[model samples]
Target: MELLKTLPAKEVIYSFSTLNPPVLHIRPGDTVAIETYDCFKNQIQSADQEVAAIDWNEINPATGPIFIEGAEYGDLLKVTIDELEIGTQGVMVTGPELGVMGHRLEQMESKIIPIKDGKAIFNERLHLPLNPMIGVIGVAPEGKPVSCGTPGPHGGNMDTKLITKGATLYFPVFTEGALFALGDFHAAMGDGEVSVSGIEVPGRATVTFDVIKGKHSKFPILQNSDGFAMLVSAMTLDEAVKTAVEETIDLLLPYTDMSVSEITMLMSAAGETQISQVVDPLVTVRFFVPQHVLDSLDIQLFS
Candidate 1:
């Protein structure tokens, strides 16, 4: 019912949010455009900005401190990435490094993806479809040194495409300001984010925003506009799967008249869990809980 403070930017800052509030006192279904840039942070001015060659210091700059009016500690920011755009016409990939799953970042060598006639041309050989995503999206770690490649439950660098437009992410607020910062926006990526990188492109984004107070979850919960609710993570492959399953059990228990034992029994049938990556060190696991079930459950009470 309240319109809150909004921010739009193009680079990184120390603490994006100063208050770390729980909810961004706002209504659902509201849409807004978010600006972003290439992950190189402009530090690597040329395509020579090779992998393992990047300074890491001058990469992945996030924009803004969109202060959520009533957000407080312990609440979840349910952000829906409504739209993603490569505001400009540029795409680059440096050398490929080791393969996460099968995509290397070192030997990959950076090449320019030229946009001609409104389409991105790949390698002058093959055309890669564009699917932009924020490589790094998260709230303030308070004083932690969260990097550009690591995504945690706080929603740092999950690197998954599911966080794209229409995917609602529930991130926990650690600091008072929640200090949300999002950057390293990629033009496109795959399952394990296995490519150490994707069609790295520059662009701005638009997101629908809202917040929930009371309780929270252990990982980013995504409700696709498609009628499915999924839990995401960046934990070790095995750990990520375990956590997702655990989260499912909890999500299911409350709605069913079933006891813990009964809930556990239904887990193998009522829904499904699967590993999105087995190579990214930080894996991506998704627990698909039907939207019908999620619709009946209370997001705030889960916290």
Candidate 2:
């Protein structure tokens, strides 16, 4: 096994863009440990701290624009998340006009939850099990700079709960070196993230990088033990869901001989449409295709 180098969170970026320079450079097979600040940039410490007081410009700080050698446009960057270590305390916030339930709230509120023995102490009476995941993970886009708060083809704040340790995320390379970065660690968060935030915490992520030449997916793909999922984001939830299904079919088309109608029928029978988060500037959704279904068809996701 090779040793891992640590990329400090001291230098962070607000957007994934080609204009941003890389803080670290590594080969395709190299594994690095990346440190990150919480979604709030670790500004909200105590419950007394007001969300309005925090600087809007400092939100969702990603650790790096790491340059992966040999990665180029039209290739796929395979990121295998090997481990995650979060801080002892995590924060959550909700406020007026912030998220889905924001319209019903009169003011902003913040909660400081303690992590103890693998659980988030929501309160004295309620303790939720920790399911640490990365809220923002992405690469530089081909054109304009994308904020860390949005999710798109370049993969920003998807806020998917499944992007945890042991999962592999694939991003389409749009520029030289891939220029990847990630942040916004969540101690635990449910689907929809209707509250505008999760148990946000500062953490470190250990990930291994690999480049797959001559192939790429239109959208980011999250792969776990069970199967592969197509992550798509759009201005509306309905649009995101529809795009996810369409992209999934497009990915399957090249590997199988099934017609579009046949694949659509199979998806209706075995696929799952799930939400990643609804609070971001764009809503994210994922369409999952089970591993068994692909296996039965003799299909390989990246082959």
Q: Name the candidate that leads on TM-score.
A: 2
Report, for all candidates in order, the number of backbone clashes. Answer: 29, 0
Shift of residue 287 alpha carbon in model 1, Å? 1.8
Minimum summed lDDT over a 10-residue window in model 1 is located at 14-23
Q: Which regions of candidate 1 fall more than 4 Å away from where they truly are?
A: 1-9, 14-32, 42-55, 88-97, 101-108, 115-119, 228-235, 261-266, 274-281, 292-303
- Candidate 2 runs further than 4 Å off: none
Instruction: Give the Cα error of residue 21 in candidate 1, in Å.
Output: 14
* Number of clashing residue pairs, candidate 1: 29
**What tens-digit string does per-residue lDDT give for candidate 2 at 186-252?**
9999999989998999999999999999998889999998999999999998999999999999989
